[model samples]
Target chain A: MTSAAQLTQAQDRFIAVWGQMAGAWGVSRTMAEVHALLYITGEPLCTDDVMERLQISRGNASMSLRALLDWAIIERAHKRGDRKEYFHAEQDVWTLFRAIVRQRITREVDPLLASLYEIRDMTAIDRKRARSDNEDLRERIDIHNQRLESMLEFFQTLEQLAAMFISPAGKGLQAAATLLSKSPREEAAP
Target chain B: MTSAAQLTQAQDRFIAVWGQMAGAWGVSRTMAEVHALLYITGEPLCTDDVMERLQISRGNASMSLRALLDWAIIERAHKRGDRKEYFHAEQDVWTLFRAIVRQRITREVDPLLASLYEIRDMTAIDRKRARSDNEDLRERIDIHNQRLESMLEFFQTLEQLAAMFISPAGKGLQAAATLLSKSPREEAAP
Candidate 1:
């Protein structure tokens, strides 16, 4: 097969894989496909270009582009003489992953962490009340508190790790990855 | 409110939050609720126990329990003189996370990696043919290869990190977490 045809096939395959991943991750498949097109082509694409290339509706292309922009994974661009706006993906892999991590932490993790803290505090009041009179209730509350604390600690650790990873000046992710890949005690001694 | 009432409310809230997390992570909410119930209670519970506590249908409870077992996050138990099978979650935080990471790697990451390798190999042949004839097409193929390579590398790094974390004898995750929590240069110097 011709190189052009082969390249097209490979691009389509990559887009399909990315779209599947988006579906699994609960994002719009069309939106992921649109991003894939822009990223793979490594060029600015207008909404019409997206629509024609992906065979998606104009509205779908526009909406996908808008959402991608909101995620900060894609940006608006303009050619010197062109009136139509164009979009391009943030092609750097680390930046793209960091953007996704930041967005998810904001959208999902932050609120969950808040709720966890609130629940623990609310339950702490009950524990205090139980402490005065009810031994059985106090024990149960203690167990519950322990469970909640462990979960809270795990999530907090994850949040801290994510923060380190996405920090602009930090190479924490690579450093941590390298550290983890080594034998724990052996690496420590060196 | 009474301590019992407050404790129940807290448990319910915990389960609800876990259920919401499940929905976002593309898992069944009921399944996560069942797991949460077992996990928070820190006890082996039968299907009837799960159903009554979660107010879910027996079928839903049973199905969720089975899936949890399949994921190896929960295991079956039997009480002497009691015929009913009970389920309990892996209570240790690290073990629980390791089980989930292992399951996801098998079901999601492994398949995706296989596809990536196949795509790369298929395009390598086209790249070789393009080398002789088409400069423009060859350049495009090279760009595509580079993109594919970066994605593959990122995923591979993640897989390696996960493997290290889940290794039974490895303190890799905690060690790495501690290492990352410290400034990289300071940690290295020490």
Candidate 2:
């Protein structure tokens, strides 16, 4: 039988690694650590369990769990005959990825796209109302507009691509893997 | 003709927006602001220019510029008979996107893939060396290994997709756009 110490070491390493990775991807370290703990145990953990295990304060544990719930990557659970609430992470890796991607697209991409469109329209209106005599100013504004349009186009394309991947009819993760596998071989030929 | 006041207002707004967007994508606010300034102006800017325009300290400006240079999204330039160093952001949108993607893949994804692989191997060795009678421990280790493998596979697929886009024959950004445009229609027909 493996000793308890060995298991603890492994779990600690996993949680540390996961927290670092998730932090880079915009999730806070505490939240990621809490999720990692739940993920490794594959069982519902009470707030106390999380706090004690991670050596974090009660407030930190509660806030972290709440943030994970906000991401929709964790859910509250209740055991039979238990009064305290517990939490469990979404176990499916693909589902977790989708949730994060969907959240980011909604929170970040959509608004940026709208703002770019507004900026472009406003610039166009300003250009039209201005006097036509200032060729130099007009030329500079045109270059700026062109750059903005190119950036807008790039973001639009990225958003559409993300939409396709997340849609029901889409093959989702497998589709990306398949494309990757096929394209390299095809491109290798003259 | 556009007044100096109008142009400054517009430039300020663009820098603010770009900085916000870039910060969300993992770049520092100062770095993004510096890049945005160079981008909108479409010219090389010295450290003094960036510091004065952004109202930031010299140290902050220098550090942000260094970070951008490390990402290779901006480059140093010099004018004839001038000793001061000036910097310019990559003007081509596609090239800029490619550089950011490539840098992230190297900095974040590649290291992550390596670490996952290492963890998986270590877990396997540990599981094998442990006493054979502990079925529960063995099962937990197996589950952990499975999770690691799944994550590794996902990252590997992503790396391949990135490679295809960066390849000369890949059509890179346009391929993603084309795929997005076609996939929805194809999926809808079913």
Candidate 3:
């Protein structure tokens, strides 16, 4: 376990780094730092643990955790002999990647498709520029739909692959890497 | 050019879908929609174009455009015919993927690692729980670091392969799929 002094200094460094990171990934600073805090803890931590250590509000901790849960990056800790329920990060790298893809698709792709559809129907005969812009939007709608279709197929295959392993335990990434390295042109062998 | 009817429907669909996708990717709804809008437009669009279409403020458009810029998904498109400085997405899919990976690394991995270091160094015995938890944090950190390293390397290789035309534009994915199918195990070719 990290000593308090060590922990604090480490946290300061972490927050600085995580803040920079959040901007690119499209997450808020506080949220990324909160997740960073949980990720570095050597053990599964509860809301109280996070709140006290990070000096955040009870509500803040709750909100961040729920958000993390939504991302599938952090898992509710399955601790032995503990009911308060701790939290841990997705330790397995491959699983983590899969989780991210699945969550991203659900949140970004599906919804964008819906919006594209809406923009296509808004019954406004504006100016030439406006009409042209609308055409562009429709193009995006088509491109994203096609892109997402492949992504969905990939995600579906991943889910099935994940289920295939007898033990849900993390496989060293080599197996998955090998799979990823394979040429895409080949379909599954019968 | 899209007619008023097509534009309205497209906008509605995009707006409806934007939220879920934004939530999933950790980006704001407005941000993703803005990107989607830029993406579909075959021509460079200025702030006004985005603002009027999305019914958002100039400030919002600026902020989000800056974000898209940082992510490298969209660029300032300067057309010789016009000085308004329109924006356009990087049509090259591989380039888009590379930019996203690079941005994510800077935004997430680098900063989170810094936080982990600081948190590791905090001194004082806050509690036995903190100590126990710290150890677990270390393991997770090590595992994550290794995984990220490998993943980054893989991305780097993908970029290289993409550049080398080992996988040609458009056909790169097909070539890769073919490569994967050729072997049950991805041993480096002799």
Residues A1-190, model 2: lDDT tens digits:
3444566676777788888877466888888899989987677999999999999999999999999899899999999999999999888776677788778889888988887877776576556544678777776777778888888878887787777666664465557566766565775677
**Model 3 lDDT per residue over A74-128, tens place:** 9886667877878887655456556655655555455544544444334323333
Error of 2 at A41 (Å): 2.9
* Per-model lDDT: 0.84, 0.79, 0.59
DockQ of each: 0.55, 0.44, 0.22
Local error of candidate 3 at A16, Å? 6.7
Best model number under TM-score: 1
Q: Answer with 2 or 3, whichever has the higher DockQ.
A: 2
What is the Cα root-mean-square deviation between model 1 and the actual structure?
A: 3.3
lDDT of 1 by residue, B1-190 (tens): 7888988899999999999999565579999999888888887999999999989898898889999999999999999999999988898887888888888888778888988898798688777787665688888888888888888877887787778777865466576675665554576573
For candidate 1, the lDDT comes to 0.84
- lDDT tens digits by residue: candidate 2, B54-131: 999999999999999998989999999999999999998777877887888887789878777776666667677657
- Candidate 2, residue A89: lDDT: 86
lDDT of 1 by residue, A1-190 (tens): 6778888998999889888888555569999999898888787999999999889998898899999998999999999999999999988887898888888888888989998998898788777787566798888888888999988877887787888778875466566665554553575473
Find the 10 residues in a row with the least total lDDT in model 1 chain B. Answer: B181-190
Arranged by TM-score with the best first, the candidates are 1, 2, 3
The whole-model C-alpha lDDT of candidate 3 against the native structure comes to: 0.59
Candidate 3 - chain A - TM: 0.56
